[model samples]
Target: MKDAPLTPPLCSTDAVLATLPAGAGDLPGAMIVWEGALYIGTAPGAGEGGHARILRLPWPGGGAVEPVYEGPEGSAVTGFAALDGSSDAGPALYAALAAPGGGLILQAKAGAGAFAPVTEPGLGEAARRWIGPLALWGGRLVAAAGRAAPLVGAIGSAELLIEADDGSGTWAALSEPGFGDPGNVAISLLTVLDGTLLAGTVNPARGFQLWQAGEDGAWEQRIVDGAHRHVASPALTACAAGEGELLLGSGGAAPTAADLPADAQPPELLGLDPATGWELIAGEPRFTPEGFKVPAALEGPGFGWVKTARICAILRDGATITAVLAATPQSARPFGLPEPGAARIWRSEDAGETFVEAAALPHPLVAAAAFDEGLLLAGLAGGKVRLRVAT
Candidate 1:
C-alpha cells in the first residue's frame, strides 16, 4: 500500500529552526548542511546586483543567522565544497565566486571563520573570466574556468580543468582528456562518486561530454551524443536499501536560438556500477517520467513542460532517494522563476529506476540539502526557504 506523504515540520516559536532573512533583491543559491550549521549562498536578485553573501545558521533547533562571508561587489558565490582537512585539522569549506573580471576561490577553516581568497593571482586571468562550482578530487580542489557572462550571445570557449593544491594553495591547469572543442568547452557539472571525480562540459554545439578520473589519476572522456544538448543536473547519490548502487542524474538543454521544444526533452537518471557502465534507470528524452507526469487535472493556462526537463537536486532519504525538480514556461525569465509554476519532489526506489511523486513545493526550488536527522532544507529562487521531514 502507498505510505503517508512526507511533509515539512511545523514551524513555531519553539519548534522553529534558524531562518535567514533575504533582502528585497536577494536570491538564494546552493545550500549545504555542514559543521553543525546550515550554510546558504545568496545571489544578487534582479534589481540588486553586487557581491553575494553566505549566511550561516545554527541547525536542528534555533539560533541567530550570521553572515559568514560577504563577497566583493559585482561577485556571486556560484558553488561550495566541503574540505577533508588533514588528519590534524577539522574539515574546511570552500566557496566558488563569479565576478565581472575573473573568478575567485575562497577557503574558510572549520568553526565558521573568515574566508580567504585562495585563487592563485594570475590563474583567474589565464582561465578566461568565470569559474564553475568547485569540487574535490584526491584531496585537490577543482574548478573550471569559463568566459564571463555574455550579454546577448553564447560563450565560444572556456578552460578545461584546473586543480588547486590544498597544502600550498597553488593552482595549476591540467591537460584536457583530449575531448570537446579545444577552444569553446566549459565545464557544466562537477561531482565525486566513490572517490572518483566526474566532470561534464558545456558544449552545446558538439553535445555534452562526461569526464572521469580513475584511481591512477588518469582521465577518460565520453560524449553523451544524443538528442539533448546539455546535461542539466550532474549529481551522485547512493541507495542503501539493497546492494549499494551509485545513481547519476542528467538531462535538459537550455533553449538555444534555434528555439527547440524544451518541453519534450525530459531529464534522465542513470545508475553506474563498476562491473557495468551506465544504464538508463529513469526518464526518457522525449517523454516525461511516469512519476512526474503532470496530471490532466492540474493543467492550466501558461503551463509549460519545462520542469520535467531538469532535475534540480537529489538527496537520500531512508530506504529511498528523493529528487526535487521543477517545470516552468519556455518564456520564463532566466534568473528567476515564473510567478506561479510547478516545483515538486519525487521519491525513487530501486536506485532511481522508478519514482513516485512525493510532494509539490513552491515553484523554482533552486537548492536543497538533507540533514543528518531526516530533515530536508530547500532554498527557493524567490528568497524563501522550505523545510520538510523525510518520512
Candidate 2:
C-alpha cells in the first residue's frame, strides 16, 4: 500500500462546547447519543471504590453530567443501548457491567432518575466465561462472552439474548461455524447492522475476521483475507439506516519483519456490507497530522521496539468519518517509559478514501461518540471528558 500525504488539521479550540463534571478516577465506557441527549457510562475512577455508573448530559446546551446509577467497586460499565417503544415509561437505557461474578446487565428509563437491576433475559454460562461487548438492536439487547482460555489455541463462542419491552427475554447460543471449529476463535466486538447482529474476532495469529447472525438464529462468517497487514481489531460505528453499510476501523499494520517506515500511516477505515457477509467496499491506511512525526527511537517493554498502534474509537457524520489513533513508535533505545506521542483525530470527508487531522488531544482517547451535528464527545485516559462542537 502506498502512503498518502497529510491533510490540513482541524482544531478543537472552537469545537469544545462544554465540559461536564465526572468522577475523579472514572474511565469513560460505552456512549450513545439519542433523542437529544448524550448517555455515557463510566468505570471506577482511580480513587472511587464502587461499581461503575451511567451518566446523562443534556444535549444541545445542557452542561451538567449527572449519575443515574452506581453499583459495586471495580464493576465497570461496558455497553449501552436504548430500547424501542416497548414501554410507556420512555426510552430504556441498558448497560453492561464487568463485575466479580461473570458480568451484569442493568436497565433504566431514559429520564427515570435512576436505574434498577433487572435479570438479563436468557443469560447462561455454557462453560463459565466472561461476558462483554453489548449492543442494542431491533428493540432487543444482545451480549457476547469471550471464552477464557490460554493465549495459544484459544477458541471463543457467542450467545444472543432478546429482552421484551417488559424486561422478559430469551437467550440462545449462536452457531458461528465459519469461525473454524467454534472453540478455536474468540469474539471481541459485537454490533447490529440492518436488523442483523455482527461480530468481530481474533484468531490465534492475531488476524481479524467478521461474522453475522440472521433472524433464523443462523450465524455465518465473512472473511477478508489480506485485508489487514497485522492484527486488525474491528471498531463499529453507525451508518445511514437501510444503506446496509457499516464503518470499521483498525490500527494494526501489515506484518513487517523490519521497523515501520518513518512515513508509516495509521490504521485504515473501511466500509462493510453486512448482508453480503461484510464485503469490503472501500479502505485506505489513514494519515497522521502534518508535521507530526514518529520518533524512530521509541519502543515497548522487552523488545525495545513498539510495533503497531490501533484505532480505538470512531465517529461518523454523513459522509464524514473521524477516527482516533493511538500509536506507539518503535524505539531503538528505551528512554525510561516513553510518553508515546500525542493522540490525533483524523477525518475523512469521502468515506475512507482520504483523511486529514481533525483535532489533536493531549492524551489518548479511550472512547468517543458523535454528540450532534458538528459536535463530538471524547473520553480520555486521564479521566478527562470534553465536548467538541463546530466553531
Candidate 3:
C-alpha cells in the first residue's frame, strides 16, 4: 500500500462571493439554483440565538447578495427546494424551518411573495419534532417532520407530510410510523430517483431504514444499517454514471457506554439500483491512496471507510460524483469545521467502488452548486461563501 499524504487539497478556492455581516446567521443548509438565482438557507450561528437568514445571489455576477427572508427569533432555516412553475402554481421556493419548538415547513412563490408556514396541525409535540429535508414528488411538495429529541423518556416519532404547490391549504399526512417503521424518529433525507421518492431515517433503536414510495404514497421499507444507536443517514444523491441509480451516505454511531466509547463510525457510502437492492460500495475498502490511514475506530470488516466527514452535498459532473463532507462533532454543536481551512471533497470514478480526496474548501462546507460560468459555489461556515474555479 502506498503512503497517503497527510493533508491533500482537492479544488482551489479562487473567489469570494459574500461574507456575512456581524450578527448574521452562519451555517448554510439546503441550497438550490432556481430560475436565474441561487437560493441559500441558513441555520443559527453562535450568539445568534434562534435566528436564520435566506440569501439570494444572481447568477452571472453572484456578487450582490439579497436578503430574501429574514426569520424571527427561535427560527432556523433547515432546508430548501424549488418547484417548477405550472399552470396552477407558479414556480415557487419551499423552506423547512426548525421552528414550532419542533419544526415547520413553509413555501413561497419562486421570485415573489414572502415565505409562509404550511405545516399541518397536531403533527407532533412541540420542542421535540423536527423536519428533515424537502423534495417535490409527483407535483406535490413533500417533507418529513417528527419527534427527535426528548427531555426525558423514549424518543418520539416521525411522519411524512404532503402539500400542494398551488398555494392551497391542503396539508395532509401521507404516511406515519404505523404506516412504516414505528421506531423511525427522524427523517434525514428526502430525494427522488427514477420518479420514485426515497426517504432515509435516523433510528435510535433500529439503526436506519430507507423507504421508497410511489405517486400513490405506498411505502416499502428496507433496513440498511442496524448496528449503531443513531444512524444519521440523510445524504442522498443521484448517480450520473448509471441511469436511475442512487447513492446514500450513512453517518453511524454507537451511543456512549461504560466500556464502549461514543464511536463515530466513519460514514458509509452505499449504492442502490432500480433492480438490485442496496449494495455496500466501500464495505471492503482498499485504502489504496497513499497517506490515507484507516482510523483506529474504522478498521474492521465493512468499516474500512475513507471519508470521515459527514456527507453534506454530492455534485455529479459527467461520470464523476463529488461528495462534499462536513465534520459535525458528536456533541451536536454546529459546524465543527476547522478554522483557516475547510471540509474535504472526495471524488469517485467508478461509482462508489472507491473515493479519493480531491480538494478542500475554505471554512466548513455546508452546501455547493455548479454555476453556468463553469465555477463551483461553496457555502461555508461563519456566513462566508466562495467560488472554486478548478478541481
Candidate 4:
C-alpha cells in the first residue's frame, strides 16, 4: 500500500564516501566499518581547534581519503568500538581519544595498522577529561569516562564506568565517580539491548540518566528524573534496536539556530520498553515513568530541525532505522552540500512505530556505516558559515 516512497539514495556529492580533514568535525564523530576500510572518528572542529583525526574511507564507496590516526593538535575522536579479534587478535579497532593528558584508548590491529595507547590516559585519572560511547556488553569493553565537547563548553568531571577485560590494555573503574552524582558530569552514551548494558548521562545540574548493567556487574537506575525532561540535559545518542528495544537521544543543550523559537530546547527521542518503561518515540510529549507519552514522531523534535540538540547519527538499515542530524556545519567545501541548512534523514520501519523522511543529505550526515555492499556516509555538514570558530 504505502511502499512507493522509498527512492531516496543519491545522498549528494555523488554519494560521497570520503571527506576527512579540515578539523575532522561536523558534529558526530565515529563511523565503523573496519578492515576493508571506513573508520572516521573526530571531535574537535571549528578551526584551529581541530585535529582529533582518524580517517580511512575505502569500502563500498569510492576510496582515497586516508589519515588513519592523527590526534594531538587539540585532539578529538571521541568514540568507536569493534572487537571480535576472533583470537590471535585479528580484529581490534577501538578509539576514544579526547586528548590533552586525560583521555586515550586507541588500539587498531589487524590491517589498518598504527593506533596504540591501549589505556593509561584518563584511566589513570589526569582528570578524566573525555572518553566515550564505547560499548561491547558481556564480553567487556564498556567505556564512558567524563567531560566532553558537545560543540564547545566542557568542564564537568567524574563520570566513570570504564572497563576492559583481559585484552589487557587494562582499564577498570566500573563507576563510582559521578554515578554518585557530582551533578553526574558525563557518560554520554553506550548501547546494547537484548543482553543488557545501557548508560547515558550528562547531567547539566539534573537531567539525563539511564543506567542498567547487571548480572553482578551492578548498575541499575534506568531513566531517572531527567527522562522527565530537564531538557534531557545529559543522554546523548544511543541505539540498540530489535529485541526489547532501546533508542534514547538528546544532548543537554548546544544545538542552536540562533536560539530558535526563542531559547532553543528541542531534541528528544526516547523509547525503552524492557517491559514498559520510557516512551515517546520523538520529541515533545509529557508525563513519563510510563504513563502519558503521545509522540510517535510526526516530524516533531529536532526532526523539526534547527540543528544540534545532539544526535548526529543513529542508523540501522535492514529493518530501517536512521536518525542523523546535528548542527554546526556550514559546508561550503569538504565533500559538498550543506550551506544554509539541509541534511535530513529519519526512518523507522515497524520497529519504532513510525517515521519517514529518508534523505536530504548533501553532507552534514555525521557518521554511518554498514559498508561493503552499500552505505558509508559522513559529516556533510549543514548550511550557514562565517563565524570562524570563536564559539
TM for every model, in the order presented, reads 0.74, 0.71, 0.75, 0.31
lDDT of 2 at 391: 19
In order of lDDT, best first, we have 4, 3, 1, 2
**In terms of lDDT, which candidate is stronger, 1 or 3?**
3
lDDT (10s digit) by residue, model 2, range 1-391:
2112222346453444455465446656667765677777776543457666777777756577777777666566766767766745457777776665555677776556677656532255434233456777665666765444212235434344444555454454455332454432444467776667777654434455666776776666554332443333322222222234676655432111011223333444456665443323233332222222222112111111132244555666666766655444433225624334334566667654556666555444445544345435453433456654431
By lDDT, who's the top model here? Answer: 4
Off-target runs (Cα >4 Å) in candidate 1 are 1-19, 46-48, 87-90, 121-127, 150-152, 156-168, 182-185, 215-217, 226-244, 251-264, 285-307, 317-319, 329-341, 370-391
> Candidate 3: which stretches are off by over 4 Å?
1-10, 46-48, 118-129, 148-154, 164-168, 178-180, 214-216, 226-242, 252-262, 284-309, 328-342, 366-391
Q: Model 1: per-residue lDDT, tens digit, 1-391? A: 2222334322111122533575524555656677777777766653466667887877655477788888767666667888765633458888877666567787788864778887753244733556656777767777766665321145524454556545655566654522445523456567777676666654444445566776665667533532132334321211221244455544444311111124424455555554544445553433322223322223211122344545555665445666555454334446643534344566655445445666655434444444455434343423454343333
Model 1: colliding residue pairs: 8-388, 157-184, 307-326, 307-327
- For each candidate, the alpha-carbon lDDT, in order, equals 0.52, 0.50, 0.54, 0.60
Ranking by TM-score: 3, 1, 2, 4
Which ranges in model 2 have alpha carbons more than 4 Å from their true place? 1-13, 17-24, 45-50, 86-90, 120-129, 147-160, 163-170, 176-186, 224-244, 252-266, 274-308, 329-333, 336-341, 371-375, 379-391
What is the per-residue lDDT of model 4 for residues 1-391, given as tens digits with 9 covering 90 to 100? 1111213642322444434444344333566776777666665544436667776656654467677677776767777888876645557888888766778888888774778777788777766657776877666677877655443454665455556555656677777766787666667677778887777776665677788778886788878756777744455554546555676667434322221122335567776887768776777667765677777765567766655445545555456566655453443235644444344556677655787766654434444433324344453333321101000
Per-residue lDDT, model 4, residue 391, is 4
